[model samples]
Target: MTNSKLLKLPSQRQLVDRLLHLIEFNHPFIFLSGKPGSGRGTLCESLLNGLPDTVRVVSLIGSAAMKMADVRQLLLQQVVARPLFNPQDALADSFFRMLDGKPANLLLLIERTDELPADLVGELWALCRHNDTLASPHKLAIIVCGNDVWCRSQKEALKGRAMPALELEVAPLSPPEQRIFLYEKAKELKIPTALLPKPKVEEILNGANGHPSAIMQSLEDIMTDRRPKKRQAELPVKKIAIVLALVVAGLLGLSYLPLFDGMGKEETREQPQEGALPAPIGSDALETNAASGAQASGSAVNGDQVARDWQSDAKTLPKKVESETVTTESTNYEGRRVVISDEVVEKLMTQPNVSGALPTEVVNELTGVSSAGATQKSAPATPSAAQHAQPSAPTAQAAPKAAVPVAVAAPKVALTPVSTLNKKPKNHYSIQLMGASNTQAVDSFVAEHALAGKVWVYKTRFRGSPWYVVVQGDYASSAQAKTAIRKLSPALLKGQPWPKSFAQIQKELKQ
Candidate 1:
């Protein structure tokens, strides 16, 4: 990645800032060619805030061996924002379908284009060349970035064929530029200057030259050395001395024996024929012989019978508990799912340890959710405070504030954003969903749903269990709130739908 400080360089600033103008007034297929480690990926991220507010940049990486189907799948994830899709149509056409009613301009950035097969590059070029006709009128622009050598080769190979009219090359940073980039990155990473010795840092800089990727690696090495890493606990000096003494004593005892010298010399007679010795039988042959002997024995066991016995035992074994999916009836506007957090995770989020991001394993452990997004993958382990108290104590006390929802209608009036909902609002009504101990699950639910109205996740400790209640769209009266819920499909109400006044919500939130 390019260090943010690289923006200070004149060439990078000019190159990135001009992308919008070049695409809008000139050509649609803009090629940004750079060698590996030239900060090509970081350049895309750096340009995000500079583009016109009307344009939304959707970035996805292209694999070296990507098929047409893989390219389609990538587009589906970025543009549609869905993890799963049925591949029935061309991805390019499906991409246009996603933008059918959306108003924003789109810039599709396919990175590592050099690694992509030539056919895919050609297809992308054609898509950009005709996006206005194929999709919305001039709503889409395409950028295909890759290594300079391969890109130049592809362009030359095409000769008089269609090429990106606004082709630009991202050159490697100069030596001084690399040092400045490293300093900026160190500051951003919060690595102290004193932790990196000048002589050693200079050695890293000289080795890295001007490559951003290399400098990042050198900086990581410096940071790692700064950490108080545990050394392999060394053996006591007495133990090491004892081992040495044993070896020396054995050698001294052997020197007094004449058989030792004779044994060492008998090597001459045996070594004369060693060169013509035959190779020993391999382990495979030994195993085959052993198996054959077992079959020939009178008490031979039947392999088929053993297999059947094992299968019978397996059939009797209890099955593992899987994560259950909570399927709510949707009006075809929502695009997210929810999992019931296991008891462990509920307890974790109920506590106060969740201030920033947690390790993924810790998240899974506390939430009782697996990587598959299942809430109850297995039962939450009972905390053993009398035994392993350290981990359980903090977990019994932590909670997160974020959760999710699907598409809902915009509110008639401006309501409080989720952040300001910490205080109980003036008495009004809202819809309460089920509570979860996992703040991550709650956060994901609201965000993935893109619930356009005011939504709040109430934090409360009920009967010692931490609960986060997700409330959507506050109304002025119980009749209006109940009326709003009744107009929806029965499938939408997975839990009991009741109108909760602000006072009631505040009571639950403050509990």
Candidate 2:
């Protein structure tokens, strides 16, 4: 219910989604609201464009006409199956039933409601109450769009309403969206300001302030002036050269001095001879050795350091060996221990030039494969293969699973592939994705398919409870339907599908 979707300006996807949500949920009212010049009307049109041809939008602009007679124009715009003969009849009720036999709902977008007097809004709200009628099975969602929230201001009139309106404010376009709009606008004009220097370009965008209307106005002025003024370069090359020369000469002069001679030369602090003085932790000359366990002359390092130092040396040990029993042990290659799988090693040994253990080329090739998809996953190969077997228990049991090949195939589907049957029988089939027959389910199916009335939800009650059944794609034959069902990515599907023909569905509807 909280439409907290961030919509990029000029891109109507989110706006369309929100409108679909309103329709699917049977939301009584939506004030197509926004700040002034936020492209509210344009957003409405964008949303309307995606709607099915069956869904009629009766646009009533409040500012354009005030008298009751002017609203008749809204009805005349659409091809009406039945026209109202009584002017005394309430506008909302007449609009609701005006759709006579429309399979889909009617969307009434009353624009510029801010211009309409508060009294007129009061009459409209009172009039909109009829939109929630159960008679005629008519669906009408009234949307009054304007810059201000009119209903909130007229709380007195909305007091007795059976259903309240949900206000959705269309925010101004974001900075990025504004930039895109400006660029596209400039493209239409064939100007180079859109690609102008950064500072100047940013200045132009900054002037727009993330508003579509402002972008059009500010971009015009900037586009007329194609280029930005270039500033002069000010690097002191001569001063830098003199500084570098002085520093180099000073370095050469210091190199000859005795003070610099002893610098950086390692002192050969010879270890104590057999019966000579020993350096201990208490001595001032004691120093640390990184590799061996000797922190001081004739003194061993702590046991931990001795272990770490030995581990480093062990990594450099040669791996080539004769008559080795371990076939799957990890090999220390290039200071990094690379796991050489027994299977890959066995395969390589079958080829020529593999007599001496495995050749370096073979090992590198095996390592490359081991790092790829082959070794990236382990869990899927086991469980996914098991799941596939479970789903088609009898068929899987009858066939022989090639061990390594089966494992490789299993990992691919372990996440989503599932290795289910790729083909199905062709028939007049429909995918029963969900159930609980109501307008809500139908709306959901519509939004999901964007197919409108071409595919629909059937309302039927089972066990004294209403069930809305969501189905899609009516195929001519069972095999065709099965193929269509297979096309549905297993990743997107929630559960096992029941693809049934219209004959099979008739029995369900009866039940």
Candidate 3:
């Protein structure tokens, strides 16, 4: 038979033999080590393929590869005849159960075994050693596959374990093996042996360093490049360079066209006009001064006597304007002062009524004026309204007379009965059930158990299904539900009800 259709690699027979031996002897622990790209994974697949269906293999890798909990879960759930228990107890119990002397075979193929923590490895080793004494009859096996670096580091940890272990190193193919590999690959691609030409095949094999994956990749590249001789053509370097230069110049022109065009349009639009006058201001004041000058000129034109008359009139006009300005200023100042005084009074009202003497400056600002006549004019014949409204003086004067009466009145109210105020009733405990299919069964069970009026049932949907059942009531403790479940014997009821927390039941119904 030709080796053309097979994966021709080094050390194939030896690895196959060792794996078979491990299976036959029921070795519980085996480690496969090799450099990356030395086909460790492929070797494991081949060995697994050769095994009988009775042997179940569980493979784990990558980030999920190291979690012992995940490993234990797979062992319990996926393996045939595996036992189940609470996770806390399942850790030790499951290992023992798998190790018991049953004839059925099991192979746990853990890839990237180096990722597992040291403590987990130690625990696993301990189980492999002591499992026979703890459980019944069956053989449990674990096969670890990883690179040489991982194997070297973990060798000490695997020592002294009861399970016989072997470390198989897979090396790269030799020159003869490379030749065989290329032949098989070429045939698989359906390429005739003569068409590959010995020199080209050998060139590919040498460049690939005899690695199967690299060699196969090169072969694929060579096969895809096959073309008819007549259509193939090669361009001179000068021609190629000219073509590339033209393409690059075109791309650069295309990139800058929009930017230069926008700048040119903006510059054209901003060109200035020939002549433009600025706007006029204060024109009304200039007009008024011009009118005054014209009036003075007209008076001179009338005659010398008229000029004297205009001079008197001009003198009176200036004085009258000054007087009018002063009167307007005085009126505005008085109005502003009154507004300021009102604001001050409002600020004083906002102040807390604390016992303190007013500051001298504040008293002066409120009562003193620029002239004494102003203050005298402001002060009233009777006390001002603010002085009459002062609360401290009146309260002090009335306190002594009111004390005894106020004290006598308080005792009368204290002597009255205190039973007039109402008290709230105590809360009653109750439960409402939601999403329950068999309400009558739950109600009857509750009534028979003397839980009537305490528990209720309601129907709802859970996870888009009409199968949701909920029971509600006052549960003194979370553990009370478990106790209730035992008494109710849910399996014997109309539907096989399971114990679930109130929060969980409510969440399911909401969904």
Candidate 4:
């Protein structure tokens, strides 16, 4: 077993030294308890390595073959057939039976002893402790390995007669340990040194959390692929050129299109033509002379121009309509379209304004009435009635009142009241408590020293001031704060004295 070269295990140097001492002193039994993966078996191997070749090692990893009869048979085979079994009971028995004075060195290593019957383990320990029963002059040593739960159970079963068990705990590796582990794994994998810089190597190690298995696996992944750095060099320049070219083309296209000029001219044309009447004639003559007459040409030209203007105006109409719709929809106006339903429109004919009050021209357009005579006859009387109804044109006199000066009350000064101004706000005091540039550190310190439920933390800032962390109304006074400061001094300012008062501390925070 010692001839097999194994990788050195982590964190068992003290155990190895103790075991060596035990073996030299011929101590009979040793029980070792540790967490899983705590290198118990490795320590045993180290002890075996220090021993002489004449001393044989019998390693029984616990299994179903742990009954007393199986133990006796195994002992018989080792002493009679092999004679090389270290700590062999058969050899001890045979020596007592035959030679009775022969000396030998025997070491027995048992792994996972918790699986063995409780009675068998107790009996074996008793035999090893009392070597006077056998005549052999040889030394006997037994080492047992098991995890915490199993070891605890076994100890409880032994009822205080068991050998003293040494407990070992395996801890996760620290940052530096992780880096060393990664470096070793990289060497084993024959990874090229230049592929990763020292900082990058440290990053990989930190990412693996110092576990040997994780470190090796990460190193393997890093070694399998080599990334090239040169591919990144030309990418930024290419992207910048593409973006600049697109921006330049967009600006040039925008410069040639006279967007506002065309819009202003179209507005001027549509406003003058909006209420103008169409050319009128008898239907028979209009249809018969539509292709040949000069009057038809004029009407056709006007209609074509109006249609073009309408199309252009339609493009700009959405802005005006949307503005009016948004303003009216937001108001409390009741006459506006509240609910546009199919049923409402079907009832439109029964409404009061359906024919008479509505403008004849608008009614004609909706009804598809082509008689231009009806529109000319109705237009003159409609405005006449509207003109005669108002006895005193109150609209002329009320127009200025409609403007109503809108009182525009000089935009209220909105000064903060004198009473509010007089009281120094809590935030002002808080800002003074929390020091500039060290607010987070101060907060953490306060939290660490605070008694769990007794203290409450608050943070605030005044206008043009730095933020602060405040521990409000301490149950204990300044002396208590001083005591807490002393206790936490190591974690704070290297055992320095605390500020004398809360106000002083707040001032220091502001500074």
Candidate 5:
């Protein structure tokens, strides 16, 4: 017996016992199957040694090249031990003659039966089917051993046959069987057990994944110190240094971001009109100027000289800072001396915080100039707001006087460009018109489309840039918003409006 037969693990031993039981009970056909490296052949050899001497054993190796004639010749040579002139008729004759008066059964072991030609395999199945018909005193048991391929083909061959074939499969080594196999393999190689610690043995068994051939190869590699050791993965030193440098540079750049934030607010401040006066600097200065202007209200002041002095001093002050620091009353001084009274100051104080160029009628009254004279002399230098309002005033004045109370009874509206959709349910849908990086562009779109109070504009970032999106919404669902697209003005429809859910907008806002 070789070392392979000597090392019969628990799984192999179980298969051997089952094979013996099937043969003892006179099973006509037996199909033994296993995968490669599962040690099925080794188990068969071990079973051969334990059988009695009276039993006859004929072993054959199956291959694709072997024909029926070749099989008969091989069988004759093994049974008769002499060359037969004609083995065709003697094939069955020899088998019956040997077992005619025998008290023992014959076991035919064909290994690697899956490699045989397709027709030859069919012939073998035919032979097993006629096992009971032979005129012999003892029975003949046919055992075909092969991998999973042969097992499937044999099953297909016996689908409707009356004869039954016993099938057995050899499984892989279990955890305990793997440990014993490794220890025995190491002993066979004359390697000391002390050299293979328990931890290394367990690792090798796991690495082999229950394959006996792999376990043997791994054991040989360890014996010769050819196995590579496991090492921790490491990054290149230059790559580590480069990554750290980039992180530090990014943090330093972020540290200077606040300085540029204030710069945008400075650039966005409105520039004063060309002939405007510089507003007084402090509250104390404004009180002093107001008292003097009040006394001059009763007398006629030189409006042209006052305008020249105001324009001359305006050049010395920063134009942008004057807008942020001045009150509503100071904004009225536009290269002219305006009458200042207690009642006028009180009314100005009571007005909402509004900032823009005054109407031409108001400017003409304060400067004490005829409408025709001011239009001809300073028409080019006049503020665009005052010029725009001049064409729309006649329409307002022509309305019936009774409409005044109706205007006062109307509800106040929010005209700011920022979206009111934030207060709505996040799941509600809206129609998106467009997006812009500047809020001014969003405001201009709303005004140009005549959708001042009908749309929402909200701030979000797009590809690392500040973005504002114009949307008309508060629809209960996306389908309703999509249906509302046709109701928009023709100018708005040209921008290709699309519907979006407010839940998505809220997510972008958080980012």
Candidate 6:
């Protein structure tokens, strides 16, 4: 129906004109032959539209099961403009005789004569020839339309009976005519011309085989299935939500970065001293103690001045520690409590080696560690030791350290590999979807179609270059493969995929 207007193009105008002339001249009999869907009925309809008012037209469909009596009954019913309740066989003959006496011409249009029985067709032609020989005042013309089979049958009958009849054929559209027809249909459908690019148009043309009906169907399919291009402003809300979720997840991931840093650092344990401040927890606590020790050492060079300064600092340390200490039962590595009493302070002040910096032996006795780097700084400050140690005490109350190693296992989904397709029997078939120059293009195509892990891609040589071919499911036979093509998505269908035997695919794979 979409191609109805295309049947009247200039390429077919002459055929319509010829048929009209033959009908007007009262040709005894005319045979119109064409392949099914070549527009035979459409051409005859055009002729009927242009006929004169005086010509009476009666159209009938021929069938293999129809008898001459049935034909006569049908014709009589049309002539009388009423149903035949109980018509006699001779009634049709009487009607024809009555028509011969009138001045008006009678035209009979029979469609699908290929399905009519041989005897029935011959009888109809005999009636037309008899009417011609009678030279009646009213002329009669019979125009029959059929496929190539009907044309051959009629020709043989004519030779056998030495009958005269005009033979005309309705041909398929030529290549140029087909192109014109497609462009016209595309315009009628309001499809953009650019959508029908040269390669795509060529594919459609080849697939349709120049049939007007097929071409029109293909164009209509394109118009129906065309997808609108997505714009940034029109992005789906789901995708935006997913992106925001990922950003939140990334922020959460940063919290675990410190754990990895902790795993790589060497763990050292320090023994708590009697009447000393709590041991450090995190690196921040260690750095605070180091800074305080350095400041204390830079104050003076004489041991007496340092002891006077130290004594004043030592008296306030225990009070500060008592006020800030956050008590917890677990205090081994993460938190420590140590008190430095007046006895240790007096002992340190009495030593002559305790000058600008505390002696290394005294520093190690209090701090329980000795390093070349530590001897340069003054002993850890008495007041600040308790301040830094309290901040790290809360870390001991956190979840157990063993829980850090507990990780969630990633999920796994099973997928059939593409390479397994090669082991299939040679007789098995598959739909070849597309071919690409590189595997990335094939992967992109699969991912875009949401076909990843469902379809298969294999390498083959094409035009002497490495080519990747994507194929659909394996099928037992080519017919099954072809049927599966119809079930593919519209986007995949546009590529014009075809069925191929595994034998052929494997042969190419070997190359």
Summarize candidate 4's per-residue lDDT along 145-200 as a digit string, tens digits: 77777766665554443345344343345665556556666676678899668887
Kindly report which residue stretches of model 3 are placed more than 4 angstroms away from their true locations once superposed: 1-10, 26-28, 62-66, 80-83, 86-91, 97-104, 115-120, 132-137, 162-164, 191-199, 221-511
- What is candidate 3's lDDT per residue for 246-290, written digit by digit as tens? 999999999999999999999988998676543332223223455
Candidate achieving higher TM-score, 3 or 4: 3
Residue-wise C-alpha lDDT for candidate 2, range 315-364, written one tens digit per residue = 56568665533444346544554455565567665776555586544554
Candidate 2 C-alpha error for residue 104, in Å: 6.1
Worst 10 residues of 5 by lDDT: 404-413
> Which run of 10 residues does model 3 get worst, by summed lDDT?
407-416
lDDT by residue (130-211, candidate 5, tens digit) is 4456565355677888887769767666744466776787777888878888888888888887879889888888887776
Ranking the candidates on TM-score from highest down gives 6, 1, 5, 3, 2, 4
Q: Estimate TM-scores for all models.
A: 0.40, 0.37, 0.39, 0.33, 0.39, 0.40
**How many collisions per candidate?**
23, 15, 17, 3, 0, 5
Q: How close is each model in CA RMSD to the real structure?
A: 34.2, 31.2, 23.7, 31.6, 27.3, 33.2
Residue 95 error for model 3, in Å?
2.9
What TM-score does model 1 achieve against the real structure? 0.40
lDDT of 3 at 336: 50
Residue 124 Cα positional deviation in candidate 2, in Å, after optimal superposition: 3.7
lDDT of each: 0.64, 0.58, 0.56, 0.52, 0.68, 0.69
lDDT for predicted candidate 3 compared with the true structure:
0.56
Q: Which stretches in model 6 have alpha-carbon errors above 4 Å?
A: 1-4, 63-69, 82-94, 98-100, 135-137, 159-163, 224-511
lDDT of 6 by residue, 267-320 (tens): 423434466453333323223355665565455433233311233335444544
